[model samples]
Target: MNITVKFFSSLMEYLPRSVEGNAMAVQVDPGTSPRQILARYRVPDEEVRTVMRNGVFLPEEDRDQPLEEGDVLTVWPSIQGG
Candidate 1:
């Protein structure tokens, strides 16, 4: 199956160099979870402050859920403002 993964803010550094932008199309086996992708990219759990799937916020508990084909998994790093 294929899905799109997007990293925002500082998390964008984790994206593959081949990826032109913050998003990349990736191939995954069936039942692949967002957590798996994060781990694959070496994205630290503490760095991930938000996770969205297809524009909807994905709760931490639900991140283990299997991702369907064409799903968009977006991640954002922790942000700080003065």
Candidate 2:
């Protein structure tokens, strides 16, 4: 299945060079989970502060849920401002 993975803020640096923009196309198994995609980019759990599937917020626990074809996974890191 094909999925679109998007990185925001500091997380954008993690995207592969082939991904010219903030979003990239990836191919995964039928049962691929959000966590697996994070792993693919070597994004640490702590660095993944927010996750969304097709604009729907995905709670941490639900990240393991299987992602469907054409799904768009957006992730961001924790932002701090003083």
Q: Pick the candidate with the highest TM-score.
A: 1
**Which digits, one per residue and each the tens of the lDDT, describe model 1 over residues 1-82?**
9999999989989988888989999999999999999999999999999899999999999999999999999999875689
**Per-residue lDDT of model 2, residues 1-82, tens digit only:** 9999999999988999778879988899999999999999998888899899999989988999999999999999985689
Model 2, poorest ten-residue lDDT window? 12-21
- The regions of model 1 sitting more than 4 angstroms off are 79-82
| Cα distance off (Å), candidate 1, residue 47 | 0.2
- Clashes within 3 Å, all models in order: 0, 0
Worst-scoring 10-residue span by lDDT in model 1: 72-81
In model 2, residue pairs whose N, Cα or C atoms come closer than 3 Å (at least 3 residues apart or on different chains), thus clashing, are none
What TM-score, to 2 decimals, does candidate 2 have? 0.92
